[model samples]
Target: MRALAAAALAGVLVAALPATAALAADPKPDIAVTSAADKANYAEGETFTITVTVKNKSSVDAKRVHYTGGDSEGVDDVVYGELSTGFDLAAGATKTVQLTGKTNHVAWQRGYGYVAFELAADNGEANDADNITSVRLMVAGAFDDLGGYVFQGESYDAGWTPQTPGVEGVKVVATSADGKTKYAEATTDARGLFRLAQLPAGEVLLTFTAPAGWKILAGENGEYDHTPALVIADDSDEPQIYVPAKKVPVSSPSASPSASPSASSVAPSASPSAGPGLPVTGDNTMLFAVAGAVAVAAGIALALVARRRRVHLQA
Candidate 1:
């Protein structure tokens, strides 16, 4: 009976050992700022991303873990209230949460601020009240008061005409280096000038297009080579772009031998002609010859009349 009782006690102890150890472990939720310290700096009123990583350090599973910013005493109000969703975490598992915040004041004066965080396990285990983790964020720059960055390039050749004129429009599009989104856009003026002001500092692509006519020589990629890329710096000035003009062949007038001769070639041949088949009436020599013949005929007729009168008198 004693041996049986000892065996029973040992079994009970083995089962309870894991439970006791888990309960004895400190219940403070593990929280850390996942964003790199160098990259987390922000300017006042500038929206930036903050990533917080939370882990269940205790052996007990945590259901529907709820978290909130602890205190804002030394922190900027602009850096708070940005978490999107709340989730549960399994024991020993980790969850990452993203929050967005804007700085209300310049962090340069204060150097850096703290963002305290509190966590509670949904499994009815209370967190260690004294062990909450607070992250420090520095403000490196001021919020940009300017609008989007403006980009301007040399105007295209005047001889270059668009394929579609009045109805079609020309636009300049600026895209992020990652190609995930378009940061800004501007329409070209009558002279094909575009401006994209106050863009974020990074590598970017600038692309322009109109209906037809105008062809882009550079800054294009892919099968048709229709896209152009450009880089923008943090302190960059207005960007200038120069696109080469596409040469269009002009059509010349067609010469046909079958067509009528030109006026200059036909004018000389149309003047009055004195050659072979033309009548002789306009010549001075012909007029003199005809007058002589008429005089001879008149003389012969006078002689005949005189002879006939003499014969009649004799009779």
Candidate 2:
């Protein structure tokens, strides 16, 4: 009877062990937003597509997984996608959804925009923070505003040290390559700062109207019609304009003929007088002048729109 009773107890304990292990296992599934991305840059009013990926990390399947896209900055708004549809995501599987969006006119104001994506599962996720992702986009078009400073100096160094002072009252105009379409124009302020707004994005010539006897030095990189070819793109970096300094005349008393040395005896003045204009050294000589002036006048302030995200709790 003792042997039979001990065998019965062992059988009951073995049956209860399976039930206890099942109760200790995790019940909730783990869903994560793996990625969200779009084109790095877009033209204003252009239609762009965004792709968001969702994954189920847990061994248990996730039911009715849904995603949503939103523009926190209001610059780019998602127009159409499977925003409301929900579908099952198998365990350790990923789903990628494609969405379409349009860039607003004001997108170029901030130079960039952002879109956010979030995921939710019916079974809930172990980590809610992993359900959110965002993408950044740079906007470029006619809605952009282009501004810079014009200085009377040689090319600046990589560290952006201006070799000369600002040239005041210089007229800077943005025109087509053929000079047929005049998009925008502005006169440099006392500090040689000029701003051209609402200029179309593309290759445009920057022609300068300077004071008499002053020369407009062509930029170092691209030259269009003897002027700088300013490509209005994402505006990641502002362009520079350097005006040749005006030459000042130096007067001297006439020397007697006896004091004058023969042409061969006269060594070129160790220091020659200033010329009417500076020679074009290279394409990159004046690249830093405008950027340097802008840094000194007012600090460059670029505010990138931040990505916004939220978690949706599902039953």
Candidate 3:
């Protein structure tokens, strides 16, 4: 009887061991902000993107990760604005999020030496030491614009011309003088115009991305090259220029000659500037020729009349 009771107690303890271990297990999640970088800086009201990466280092997964980015003098405090990633991160997984933030002031003040970016998880994290990062950037620059109409280099009827405002939504990119490091971009508007504001004072190239069935004409730089580099004086708007898009002539089948072709010669083509086959006016040669012929005929008629009168009188 004693041996049976001891065996029963041992079985009960073995079953409870797993339950006790599980209850004591800590499901803690550790999330840390690994790195943050400022891709570029922009003026107040200008938009820019920041890259933030976070890792879930704990044994449990993290959910609803949130990120807040701001600028401050110390770069440690999140003073500007915060945003949520609104996603789940698996344990041992790292995620890179691009957070876009705008400046509250027009220009970046010199007092703010650093930018702060932080990441957090909805599930409480065990360690919060690594959740923030900071970096410095140059946010000083002026705004300028280059815009113009894009049109077909062709003339139409009625001596009237039109612009290719049809090219709305076309992309125009502004880049450094070396044609690298894109500064900004804007889509052509209904007026076929695009502007790149907050530009640094220096020579920069403007490149137009051709839409379907369109191309820019050759220039001093090169055919279809990023347009000639332009100098933007401090806070000065670059002068607008006209851009021509190549037009492909449409082809149509020529009608067969009439069943019975006429013997008459085909008329001459119109003058270069004139619309149709209209004769040019005031031909001095023609006028003189006709006048001489009329004078000769009159002389002959007068001689005949005088001779007849003389013959009648003599007879």
Candidate 4:
């Protein structure tokens, strides 16, 4: 009887175990950051728009899914600051939330910057791996602006250091470090200064199609033409790029000096013939000399004949 009673209790406990487990395993929302992106082309001293996509991986809907943004301080692993933004995410669905953040000066020591995003739900998350994400950040000084002049000639050895005179009306393009994505464009003003604000810091490439007859000065790398340049934009780094321009046709001066003078001299070909007074050229002077000689000889011959006739009559 005792063994049967114990077995019955054990069966009851086994049945109750599932109920306890079910109670413990509550229905929770699993939210995670699937992707994090910089919504705007960020620059130093400019505000950045960070977009975080949160996915509800659980079967239950995630209510009041909130997002926060942070950045690692220059060469440091610590992240600070939380942007205030939130949204509701349906089960098996994704919601994107945007927040604005001001970036600090770029960390040149690390050679790059970074931004982090965290996604959470009202209840709780089942997995943490997907809830946090980070990406490469590009920034300049938190309050600084980037601009410079484009002129003709080779860029001085350390030209990008200061704000030099700019070339007006030049179209400049700023692209992603990979050179595939275009961020923004600006036309230099009358002062030759063109500014794209809130630009991110990283290996950014610039594309400038110099004027038809102009060429951008070669950079420190010794290559002219704004094709691909890895520019580091930070407070410690040089925010301005001074480009010295050289004329496109390098041989122009040499080619022009002799051509104009030579052409003008040849154009006066008919001027000598059309002159108001006759020009005494070598050919014209020879003709005049021959005629004078013939006249003098005729006079001498006539005088000789007169002398010979007088002598004959006397004889």
lDDT for model 3, please.
Answer: 0.60
What is the C-alpha lDDT profile of model 3 across 178-223, one tens digit per residue? 8778878877776666677655644567777766655655244226
Model 2 agreement with the true structure over 1-315: per-residue lDDT tens digits:
999999999999999999989877757678887544467678767777777677888888988887644445535556435545888989999888776777765565554566776777877777787888777666754444567666664332212234446678888888876889898889887777788877655456778777654555554532221364544445645645444434334455697577666676444444456545444454453567887887765643422111112222321
lDDT of 1 at 55: 71
Q: Which candidate tops TM-score?
A: 2
Tens-digit per-residue lDDT, 29-94, candidate 4: 887674444543444445555565667888988777765444454333332223244566788997
As for candidate 3, its clashing pairs are 142-199, 143-198
User: How would the candidate models be sorted by TM-score, starting from the highest?
Assistant: 2, 4, 3, 1
| Best prediction by lDDT | 2
Q: Quantify all predictions' global Cα lDDT against the true fold.
A: 0.52, 0.65, 0.60, 0.61
Model 1, range 1-315, lDDT digits (tens) per residue?
A: 999999999999999999999878746443322332335565545555566676777666666666644653223433433232446677688776665554544343333455566655545544465325665665543212112211222223322234322212456676755667887877665555556765553345666564454444444322231344433233334434544434334455698569787775443333456454434353576567789999999999999999999999999
- For model 1 the local lDDT of residue 1 reads 100
Query: How well does each candidate superpose onto the true structure, as a TM-score?
Result: 0.31, 0.39, 0.32, 0.36
Off by over 4 Å in 2: 1-24, 36-38, 68-71, 75-77, 142-315
Clashes of 4: 19
| Better candidate number, 1 or 3, judged by lDDT | 3
Q: Residue 7 CA error for candidate 4 (Å)?
A: 6.4
Stretch of 10 with least lDDT, candidate 4? 74-83
By lDDT, the better pick of 1 and 4 is: 4
Q: Which model, 2 or 3, shows the larger lDDT?
A: 2
